[model samples]
Target: FFAGNGNFYTFVVTATTNGVVNINIPAGVAIDYQGNLNTASNQLSRTFGNEYPVYTSSNSGGTISPVSASVGQGLTTSFTVVPYSGYTMTVSGCGGSLVGNTYTTGAIVAICTVTATFTQIATAVLPTVTTGAATSINMNFATGNGNITNIGNQVNSKRGIVYDTSSHALPGNVAPASSSYPNKVEEIGSFNTGAFTENITGLTSNTTYYMRAYSYNSVGYSYGGEVSFTTNIYPTVTLSGYRIFSNINTLNVGTALEAQNTAHVFSNSGDSFRLRFLLHIANSNLSVNGGVFKIQYSLRSGTCDTSFTGESYTDITSDTPVAFYRNFFSNDQVLLTTNANDPTHNSDTVVPQTYVEKNNFSNAIATVPMGQDAEWDVSLFDKSVMDSTSYCVRIIKSDGSLLSGYTVIPEFTTATYKSRGGGGGSMYIENIATPGGTTTGGGSGSGSGSYLTKCSDGIDNDGDNKIDALDPECHAGGTLQGAYVPSNDSETVAPALPTGGCTQNCGGGGGGGDLGYWIRTVYGIFGSQFLRNSMMGSVIVSFR
Candidate 1:
């Protein structure tokens, strides 16, 4: 290579691979303009190199961060352009921004690089992730402060939390651009991030979730450290309850204005007993959400009945047995009113109480409504002392719709040592009519002594053709069990139950259970059974 006497000439040399390449001009390879020959050769050697498909960056007024990258082929990388002190910046290429000063490159099919121009100005930054929590089966959220502190200038930006069970990928991590979360992943957004929280919701339950607070501007998504939380698991609905009254009205005891502590329900023929018990119900998610839940009752009497296959209940063919609300007792007189707080009068449609009605078959006796408070959902029911050969009082839900999964209906069987009947016994709750005439309805045997003996009055108060013990009213223990009287009427009002209530051997099957009151009756088989288990001394024999 020589520059002739004219001026200069150009020569081209290409590098073939990675290594060194040398170009040397031999002796006399050049001549000076003054006709002087070059004594030694001017040597020029160059080294060739292979492609760097991963690393590339640039800096102008500011610095482009991840100053250099080494992520292998096929994957993407995020880069942030932090401005120098007293300098403003701009970016170009790789789907990156210079204004925001941050850029996340797409897939690394080849080398990824960017160029920027930054002017002298104040510096900027990224947003801060403050706090987060998982609250329900389908909802969770994160709170933060969004400011261009360590990040860059923000134009139209996206900010929220991206979450997963195991993966820590951002929302835009996938190639086709979706999420990698396994469950149904939805996000809460658009209202206002300035409002302080990024709501993460509509995810699955009983699962471990991973989340990262994020802000996506021209700078892709700026994420916080990965945070993890597990969702709450709600248990399914389960129905459980025991008998309300065996011998005592447990509802009137202790904090137990509700029924509790009675024998496994044992119904007796010709015996009057009141229904006073509790019901534990849960998981109404399958029921009404923000509405009142209603309860209903049905009975299957006569013989060891076949299993209830959930049918043929509410068909009271004749006018004698239409469903109607009643006071604590089964009154065909004035139906019980709904709750005083009821604005819709829903309780007017059925029984205000939840008693098990007597039936020889699958008969729907009463339907009652429940209140809103969950803890106080349990209430006591009153049975109309109706006796049947083999009867049952079963419960079910009446939400004007059907329910799913486990059987919501639980039955209480009544098979006891029968007690001789006497209508309007001590067990009668709030009866108006009379046996000897106590009710305003002017029932049989009306008298001042007669409390509410609509049954033994020998008058057909219910017009069911039956009289006293023969009537279902007597089965509630109208006569023999004596009548039910309030136990705690200020305690100053003289206990109305045992004294004011029934003085006769109502059903001849003395009382038993809570309130510790024994019914005044003839010492019969059932009476002996209750006394033997609860009162009588133990029996033993020894030989010497």
Candidate 2:
């Protein structure tokens, strides 16, 4: 060491296969050993160390082989990190934020040290929201620590962001399809944390709508997603008039009034419909003893042969016979006038007063129109009679056409007695002698009595005792019984006189006609048979 000098000392040596000859120098002195000494000769020389390259046995302290230390802490404590390549041997804890580098060269040290640091990146911000023009706006939070009130307003800035309200309008501004329409929407409210419940109102009967949610907070208003819905409509019906049979002529006798027919239908729902004619009637007098009205007609054309007289009249040929029975007085005559006049007029007398006989009854019938119905009105009966009397008004249908038939009236009742011109003996004697004279005799059988004799035949050759003047039974009974004087008139006469017979020996003389004169004693067949059993002549009485 030298005074007042910051320098080092050094030494130099010359070496060969022999030994090194060193020349020492003082501190701060520069020594130059420039002479080249040859040690090739094998002469006697001092022993020198073996030839070796410039080498260092141990590195001194503070020897940083490559680079300098960085700015941040680079701790390498055993509790923190294991030693790695390029790590410094002086650190005890891991380093803080990385700043620069500090490299080393020798074999890796077994100490812990700081190396590098990681950087953080920022994310995009949520989009702004807007208020809805219609119903209340809503908002919601997706994935952030902030307000989630207005769910519709807070549109997510990132993907998977969404908001919704439970209620929505129909597609066409229409009310909901449910029975409860616009009012139903008001139940739910608007919100954020979860999906919003927005109940809108004031919707039309049938309309559609479009909407979206809106949210607002310290950040701003954010718009939600869009959606739409539709509602339902109703149905209605219309009608024309409710008139059924408003103008029916109820007072018209023997006339079947018109029935109720047309109608209208309406509906709200789209459905198919149709209708049919229905009829309802009250109590009627069209029957005997409340019996059903009779329709006396035939589909074929011909008169109904109710009488067994074998007389062929006209035939009935009606398709839809709607005729009903009616009652009338026995003396009533169905006049045949040829003119189609009113029922009250003489011109309307189609058939004159003939005793509305069986053959004199009407035969017309009627039928209703197609797709139409038929109804009847009957008159009430005052008294219940033993014999059934029927008068029919028939309506006919032929090949789909309507034709009416005349009504037929028939009656039966107790026969009444009617006085003619003479007594029993005179009438009998006159009827036997003359072909058609009465018993009121003359001196030579002259006078109206002569005419009566022509009809008075006790034999009943024509099956009519008073011998044949319009005897309906002539066409009925043949050659026996008395005459058939149809009681169409108020009075009808009996063919045989009430009293006539031979007073002596019951013979054919003595101012008496014959024994057969007493035959009138028996009225019924049993009485006549009893008379015959007694060995006396059987007598059947005339219509008394």
Candidate 3:
């Protein structure tokens, strides 16, 4: 039985005979839109526009017709009253109905007609859930007479549920955010677009989840359909630093410097560059030394702006105990001159050598030493130079014969050593004394010093009777290497003489420590060798 007309109750009809249809409405009962009872009316009804009717009829010696009713229409509605049996009642607000009549023992009998209503339950639609995506679904309801309200609790409870199973609406309600880079839950938005989303983060690489949506209205809670999705896979690679090398074994200074410049100039050169990888590592410090380092770099098919050359060398192996960083070392480099006979080149063309494949610094820095002549000579490429057609300077290896990295500076051009002054070449010697020291300068050339010598006379000045160039003991060579003087070798009154040779022996030296007598001797060597008795002694020497 079901409620009808707010107070009327209708009984479900069962077939009595093969051709007889029975309609039974219980007295004083009504059916609400749902299965609940509505007691306001003892009559139940519905109206059909132009499509309501008992189109087909099965009769066991009976006749049937339609009927109607309305609200507050009080009538003792029973299951046996029929219109064909002369039972009539007027009730307003009622719609389609049915009436039936039968004849029994030559007497007419009528059966009452009953109406039944069907209503639908409300429901929601759920969207598919992904491991790293925003999710949402809609909530909806179905009721015969529109009696649902307040749909908040159901949707909010399961708003973020992103996983599901047969028994559970979502096996994993809480999932990682959509962006693992930022790694956090983000409440994006919840509009009428049929979903409420909260971004999840920190998800494992490859995983899956199931999800469903739920909603609540004034009527009841409703649920949406379930969905599932999977995440993608990624590689597990750990990237550190890079290393470069030239000439194979020794730490290539230019290669290491280029790797450093790649970071600053190129910006896209990852963290490191390498060649002939001696050791590849990370997390440790690195350094370079021991060669004339020249950094040659161009702006990707453009012009190169600067060059470098190492002067002094230092060894900077890892300071830390651990060798976690890469190490690169290369042999020293030698520059080739085009004017001279070629060593590393054939005719005038410089052949390229083996590719450098490692980074010299574990930290990716080109450590240039101090006082190095670090500059680049730009090649002026006027149309006139192209017309003349020449080559540039080339770089050679330490063996005076080995071929190595690129050499394009001094090959076919006359710009070699122009930017750097040489010939009476600029000597860069280390550990030389500071300026004005006893050791004036340190270089490849020899040095000079000052000394003193005795003057000679025609007389037996020292009583040895030696005179002029003929004196064996006094005159041996033309000039003295270094010596001290004594006025005892000459009797000459002194006037300060300009520096020059003595008349007799320019090579001979005298015992020193005589001040006045030495002054007299120098005066006599350059002027008159005649000194009074007051000036006669040895001399002390000093260097200027």
| Model 3 lDDT per residue over 419-514, tens place | 110112122211112322221111222222122223432234445443322233332222221221222243232222225553211121112122
Of 2 and 3, which scores higher on lDDT? 3
Best by TM-score: 1
lDDT of 2: 0.24
lDDT of 2 by residue, 470-544 (tens): 233321132222322221121123333213442211111211221122222111111334444432221222210
Q: What is the lDDT of candidate 1?
A: 0.36
Question: Please, what are the lDDT tens digits per residue for candidate 1 over residues 1-544?
Answer: 4456535545578877655566775656566667665654467765455323444455565666666776544455667777777776666665544335557676555566666566776333434333245443321222322222333444324555556679644444232135554433223333223423444555444567776555544434455565677654322322233323222222221122223322334443222333332233233221112222233345544322224454344422111122211123332212222332221112222222322222211112222223211111122222222332223333334434322222223334434433232223232222223333221111122112212234332234566543333333343233323332212122112222334443532211122111111121211212335434422221110111
Winner of 1 and 3 under TM-score:
1
Ranking by lDDT: 1, 3, 2
- Alpha-carbon local distance difference test for all models: 0.36, 0.24, 0.25
Those runs of model 2 whose alpha carbons end farther than 4 Å from true positions after fitting are 1-341, 344-388, 393-544
